[model samples]
Target: MSDKKIITVFCATGAQGGAVARALSKDPDLHVRAVTRDVNTQKADKLKSLGVELVQCNTSNPASVRDALSGADGCFIVTHTDFGKQNSFEMEVHEGRQIADACKAMRVGSVVFSTQRSSRVLGLQTRHMDAKAEIETYMHDLDLPLTCVMVPCYYEQFMGLFKPEKIDNNKYILEIPMGTTPMHLIALDDMGVVVRQIFNNWQTFIDKTIGICGDVLTIRDVAAILTQVLRPKTFADKPLTVNDYRNKKDFPGVSDWANLFTFRMRVDQIFNIHHTKMIHPQMKSFEEWARENADTLHNVL
Candidate 1:
């Protein structure tokens, strides 16, 4: 029997969990058990190729969660909001609670959970964020040895959901709801690095909630960086308010996102970029991320 510590990573095929699995798999002192809904996918195959154990798991099922976390010394968990799904908040909370309950029952030594601030408690109704916050509270109530990591908006959103809209004349407009407030941002890959450090030094993070970010910049700063990287296709930041964003009903979760932005604007110190840099010295800034993803950005245009 190997004496190495076992770490189970839930949602190992997705962005956040996949990064954690890849990072932990590199440590000889730790064994990574990657849990996914399906083990036959290309992403799962890649993890298998790295000598990580893959287990099929449905997070919403209590028995499945327990089976996956049966012998884990530590675990990393992230629950998605599944926005636009009916009762999305309730569904997320259920899934998260199931996982947390399993961790408690299985007596997992350390748990690193990805959670967010409670917009509900702050007088707003960002269901997604509140759902995660509710899960965090549940874990705390269980008296589980837990470390909560709160991530800000992802830099990867630029490639998908938050991609700027192109008007005429090769110009693009970025329409984030923050007028002049600096928004915290992180690369998904960098989250892996930070979580790895947290797991490596679990005792230090026990019962602590950490908010991490790679950069904090206004929408205009983001646009400027994009313009610098993709010069021929100029980018500009639109001065859109939270109310304006809330009025955009064409997209799913508009009100939730609008409330989230409003909360962020009113709140201070949502993320600590300096502390995050201390944890992961090589975390990528927005400019660095934009420069590296310039080709993909161009392709999307």
Candidate 2:
């Protein structure tokens, strides 16, 4: 057996897993085995170039997952909530359970499952959030060491779902569901740094569920920051009530986001920004992240 601890990362071609895989590979005491469905992809080749071992595994297949978990010291698992036209809450739960069972059988030293806060925490049910909550419970029931790392809304959402629209030559409008309640947001890249910290001190986080956020901001707050960066005549905040947003027939995942915003209003401190800063001292704030990505954000705005 190798002296280095092996950490298996699922969805290594995707965002969260890729970040964790890269970070772990840089640690001298650890060895990274990156899992992906295809072993011949450009991304997989890049990971291999960085000294990461490539493991071909499919999350939907129990045997594949089991094989990947074998001889692993720790694992990072995440499930996608949206798959284009096919979105099923139960599918995510099923996949999560599969990974959990595999980890339990293999007796992995530590399992860091990327999850979301429970919908029940805010008195509403959103499909994605609810699925992750169920997975968290299932992992705990299996009697394995688990750390549920709940990531907040991505700051990158501004590039897609909440993209700014031009109202005039020099003005743009930012639409948000939360009227004035602060929404916790984080840069996806920073999630890796935090996860690396968790892996280094696994005992401190076992059986704990932590929500991480880089900043707690409102629509107006975001606009103010963007105004400084984009030099817009005026960046306006257009607040959408949960009811109004949920009823929008044109918006994708309206009901899901509606429930999320409603829950966010009920619990402003769900992400615990202060505690997150202590865990990953180098984490970036919204302003800092915006400044760094100003050119890219400006194009979308």
RMSD of each: 1.6, 2.3
Per candidate, the number of residue pairs that clash is 0, 0
lDDT of 2 by residue, 1-301 (tens): 2998899998898878888888888888888999998999999998999899999988899999999998999999887676233457888899899999999889998999998777786667688888888898898899879898998888888787877878889888887778878888988778887888899999899888888989988899999998887785468898767787667536556777778877777765557889999998889988899899989987766
**What is the clash tally of candidate 1?**
0
Against the hidden true structure, what lDDT does model 1 obtain?
Answer: 0.90
Candidate 1, residues 69-97, lDDT tens digits: the string is 98899999998877788799999999999
Look at candidate 1 and tell me the lDDT of residue 271. 86
Superposed by TM-score, candidate 1 places the C-alpha of residue 244 at a distance from the truth, in angstroms, of 2.0
Alpha carbon deviation, residue 291, candidate 2 (Å):
0.9
